[model samples]
Target chain A: MSLSPLAIVLLAVTLLLGVGFYGLLVARNLIKLIVVLQILAKAAMLAFVAAGYGQEHMGLAQSMVAMVIVADTVVAVIALALAVQVRRHYGTLDVRKLTTLRG
Target chain B: MALWTSSLHPFLWLIVIPVLASPVVYLAGRLAGAALARWLALIALIVTCAPCVLAAQELAANGAATFTLGLVQLQFDGLSLLLAGLALGLGTSVTLFSNAYMRGETGEEKYYAALLAMIGVMVGLGCANDLFNLWVWFEAMAVSSYMLVAFYRDQPASLEAGVKYLVQSAAGSVLVLLGIAAVFGATGQLSLASIADSVRQAGATQATSAGLLAAGALMTVGFGVKAALVPLHTWLPDAHSQAPSGISAMLSGVVIEAGLIALLRAVSALLGEGDAVARFGQLLLLFAALNMMLGNLLALKQTQVKRMLAFSSLSHMGYMLLGFGVAAYTGQSAAAQGGMFHMLSHGLMKGLAFLAAGALLYTLYVAKGAHGPLMVNDLNGAARRYPLAALALGVAVLGLAGLPPLVGFMSKWQIFVGGFQAGDTLVALLVIFAALNSVLSLAYYAPLVNAMYRREPSHAVRLGAAMPPTMIVPLVVMSILVIALGVWPTLIAWLTEPAGQALLAGW
Candidate 1:
């Protein structure tokens, strides 16, 4: 009745993805949204490593994880910078107020 | 199958030159002058075209070019070369137009640098042969674009659009990465060719392998955001309308199409064993139909000129998707060729439309002393003052509406013909539906044209600045190509035929 290590890892990854998506759906603050994105990246990175482990290609998986980390960080940095600008210009951190460009 | 061969590894040259030189352009702006940096950026884009042309030549002679540069794999077939050439061509025009449009604007260095970087990665995306490599290039392009989209940080609209775009696009890329993970897990390979071979050898079907189907669905929705497919296209209208006009042209013209191509590549790799491709094509067609209807319907209510164009871009994406869907469904090269040609046509036509609109906006700001974005009403009798801009805009809108004398019509015709050639009842009906949608788009396009030439001068157009030659030249060039290509599409057969064949022939 015991699950394998791979199953355990995959379950964790799925849980992370679900939580991250839930945060995205509910969170309004830009910073929290960015945190959610980071959470999602963790899931993706974990999945990559687990997939590599499943295939016995740990080296490839690790290198892919490294690249994802760098790319994910760049996204965070940009998102945070934009968030700062958003707060300054709009005078609020809520995304609901960004309705200037209405259809 | 070999038609030609070249030892020159132009793919490396294509990617490395602009990417490596982008910072140099930024430095020159800081140390030398914005003018120097601007011209340098233009020169850098022009120089990058050399490798593209050489690769095109190689593709012409050899039918395809695949080579490994260090650890990264690259190729120059019809499909890759067409995309590279389109990006470079659009990049050159945008850079040239910005010289006049962005004059005296702050942060000119960062603008040019990010623009060049985006172009570089777009070229890389075209040439990428590995799935992970494609993802990296896509992320690089998306990152550079987020910077460009928020270029006017003081403007709240720009900042909002930038953040929205950043979040949606970031989420989409993460989805794509997860899909790649699932794909690698299923096939144990990352190169597209190997993945396809493995999937085929295993005879994987939707019912047989839930993992691969899940991967395909995830990638579709992931890439769909960037491609601006309906339901995932919320960020596009805002981002395209708020960014500077040159960037707007790039975003509308080539960037979204690049997303579609990336999706096409990924999906093509998954197109083996059972009804996988057919199911994917059915999904594409559903999106295509929605994109056409909703895009045109919403566009009818927009007061802003750029917003209208942005919405219209979604509809155009629909047409191109229809072509690809038909191609995928029938396993024929005809519809895909039609789709490829439509990409080329739409890239030129829409780029010209946005640029022409941009010229009018620039003049409105400079001469008429306007403070905000241009509205369609602002174009009332614009032809009397800015004749060339008005004419260019007219040609662009009409072409986009698929009038018979323009390149848009020819491409749409090709797609319809492709659909009919499929001999599938539903696909044929979809072709009819698409034709009706094309006519529906003119509901707005025609009015814009009428406002330009048929109405009394609006206050905004009464005394606008003389249209700059830098802006006029690109519109003239693109307009000419649109007409000439429509009249003689055979001229581009070398590009379109090979590209469509490459997509159908698979990795």
Candidate 2:
């Protein structure tokens, strides 16, 4: 069966989310985690843009997705800055070793 | 026409004030020393608070109002009002406290500036009405939070917690975004109300139903990471316990609530009137129960004060979940009311606890003249030295443990009664367990009080003249409000009722 454009976009988004989440769960490096999160954000935006397909009205979905992209970029930048600090201080990005906060 | 013109759109001011003030706070940092930076942050927050208070008043008086931002709409409803008020109130108090709290610390400017920006983002998230808009503000809040977490750049643990928090939060945002995308794909709408309407009309097709359920689950887990719910809550104790005390207060007190509100909004829209949503609610109930049990049980074993509070926060999140579970399962008016009430009350109470803790830490730092690695035992016999700070701590803990004549008990009562009224026997049992957990919480809380009051004086327990009034005043104010709300819960109920009504209005 042929899929609609929306369906294809939806499937791609599903893949992206799945991959991103898998990477998030399995990845131990802070930088790689950030990259996966960015990918995940893009997937969500793609799904959003695709949802507005076939509508004759204004590009509401497009603009909203654009806004989300901008927000994600900002978050990524800040996360990277924090990660840089972590690397400098901790000398490594492995999450398991950062357990100085147990009660 | 003049009368109407004189009163600007309440929603407009709510959004604009924070957006406008963020840059000013950032710019002000460059012009002056830490003193000016603190004042600027405080003024910016005060300005931000004005609009939120007005919007809340308008919500109380005229009901929920919607203002369009392009195709997306921004609404100032009772829920918005309640969340915004808590965010702003805590934001203002914390700004004041941090002003003095961060004095003499290295890199103070960046700390205050980032904190001010975070407050703006949090207030915006609280006020945002549409799904897409909520996501934008939520990300904004996350970014700022990551910065604050890593503010102490020299501390390895602080940096580590910041990285962990960022990675986890970023992943969660992605999941939420994908869920939003899926809902948009199915419904062709980004507005929460429109999405709910389309989902309701589409009925339960295998693909659509599955897609929505998957999306909902993804969003729930995504947000669960931020809410510090169990299983996904691993980051919280590390993040909250390692950050600078002022930043810790903001993180525990207000930042996590942003995620919780987002999840609640999404769940309410998805499950407003559907069996699928109801099933989803059941899943949430199970998660809530597990979170409640694990969070408190874990806290009992912690030796660190900050880490203990972190675990207690996890338990509190479970209590908030109890409110959400009842509301979702039965959608009873009282249950919904209880959920919103708990959100408001928890925000204030938790914010107070963290700030008071920060004040105690500050006093300890001044007395010891030490720069780093302060331990819990360092706080032995603190009460005789800093009676006022100890009083603040006592009130905050008592309130947190849900003792009567304090706000915590009032909020818990609403949630417990609502849970029982909804006939969720398991949840009611969980609520009872939660109440007992509060009593057990006293075990942990009482020590700080007892250590301060009864233990032999340690050198670190002595007071210093350097403890600033700015920090002291906010803690005292919050402590007083905790008691005031307990004696007169109607004040909070009045605010929460309209917000709950607004949440359920379209449904």
Candidate 3:
């Protein structure tokens, strides 16, 4: 059976979420993890806008998604700053070896 | 309808002062001096705190005060007021303590910038009635805090901790937004009040509805990470321990509680019916119980003082969660009231504890060149060296361990008594488990307390001089407040009652 437009959008969203989570779980590098997180944030934005689609007050969803993108950008800037700092401090961006503080 | 007249009258100053103060503190700190910057922080905090204290007193005496922002509404009710007061009051105390604690430290301007901005966003987080506005404030707080945590960028551990914080919380923020998206989609509403109205109209059956449960689970996990609720709590021990102790005070004191309140808002407001609440509350109680037991267990194993305090912070979050769970399960105002009181107690007591520990670290830094592990063993005869801090630490840990005649005990008493029914065996057993966890926490707390007085001083501890008076001032004030509030538990109850009632009535 052919998927409806909503179904296709949802499928795309699901694939994006899966890819993002997979990258988060499997990525060995800090930069990879940050990129994966950005992708996940993107999926969330897309999902939010899609959730608002075909409904009354679609503008609300659009506005919210725009806000989410702004927030995601803020987080990205921080993440990149942190990455530069981490690379400066640790000499590498591999998260697996970044185990300085232990319980 | 004017912007300053009605909608933002009370909170406008509370919000604007700190947000505005961040840049002012940064600029003045660099141009004038650290002394002036510190004075600015204290003054700014006082300016922000005035409205909160007045609002809290007014809320206590006259019930809730409402400030409507067009379609949005901000209520100066008990919970928001109490948490807001905790944020601002502790913001002042932390700034004062930082005056000494952060002395001669590099990047002082940037340090004050993050600290002031974090305080403003936290206060705004407390008053936000619109879900999206609340989320934005929460994210803003997180961003500012990432800077605060990693302020010592020269240190590898600080950056590591900040990186871990950002990586984890990004996912947490996404989850929170996802939950909000689901709720908006389900109800076509973004305002908390409107969402609750939609949920109430949907009735008990929606408790099991796929979309609602997803919303509940997502939001709970989202905020739970920030609140340091169990498995999601790994970032906290590192973040709190690695950050400067003054910043640690704000993190443990205000941020976690605000996270819980935001989570509670999402859960309680969006899941307004009986069945949904019961199920969600059960889940929260499970998380609460786990957080208490496991967090205390973890604390018992920590050798480092700051790290131990971090674990204990997690345990206290469990107590806060227990109170929130009660409100969730039973729609009981008593539990939320207790939770608010718990928030107040945890904020003040933990704030004091971290500052006192920072005093020891500060002394070590001053005496020697760099601070060491801050292990419990490092506190050999700290009492004789830094008497005020040691005394403050003694009182703080006692309060944290939930001893009688301390604020911790008062909050725990309210949580257990208000949440538990008289005759239910399982519930009573669970309450006992919670109480036993508090007692077990003394396993770690007692050593820290005893290390202050019972042991002979190490050469290093004896060499260090006393903490500066500015640092001591906030510690003394907080320790006294913990003791005073404990004695007059009625005072906290009165302040917190309206917060709970407002939440329940709003729901």
Question: Considering every candidate listed, which one attains the maximal TM-score?
Answer: 1
Per-prediction backbone clash count: 3, 5, 2
> lDDT at A91 for candidate 1?
96
Candidate 2 chain B, poorest ten consecutive residues by summed lDDT: B366-375
Q: Candidate 1, residue B26: CA error in Å? A: 0.7
Query: Predictions ranked by lDDT, top down?
Result: 1, 3, 2
**Best lDDT goes to which candidate?**
1
Candidate 3: give the clashing pairs.
B78-B499, B79-B499
Writing each residue's lDDT as its tens digit, candidate 1 over A1-103 gives: 6998878888988899999999999999999999999999999999999899888988888989999999999999999999999999999989888888766
Candidate 3 TM-score over all chains jointly: 0.96
**Native-referenced Cα lDDT, model 1:** 0.89
lDDT of 1 by residue, B1-507 (tens): 232343557766777888988999999999998999999999998888888788778777777777765555787777887888888999999999999888777889889999999988998898888888999999999999998999888889999999999999999999999988888877778888888888788866564367777788889989999999999999999999989999999999999999999999987787675477888888889999999998999999998999999999999999999999988888767899999999999999999999999999999873344347789998999999999899999999999999978999999999999999999999999999999998989999999999999658998787677888999999899989989998998798888898898888772
Per-residue lDDT for A9-79 in model 3, tens only? 66776798799889988998888898999898888887787678734567888888999988899899889
DockQ of each: 0.84, 0.66, 0.78
- What are the per-residue Cα lDDT tens digits for candidate 3 across B376-456? 877889898788899999999999999979999999998888678433465567778899999999999998888889558
My TM-score estimates for the predictions, one after another, are 0.97, 0.93, 0.96
Regions more than 4 Å wrong, model 3: B1-8, B60-62, B202-208, B366-368
Kindly report the root-mean-square deviation of model 3 from the true structure over all alpha carbons.
Answer: 2.0
lDDT tens digits, residues B184-244, model 2? 6555666887777877777756776666777788778877778877788888988888787
| Fnat of candidate 3 | 0.73
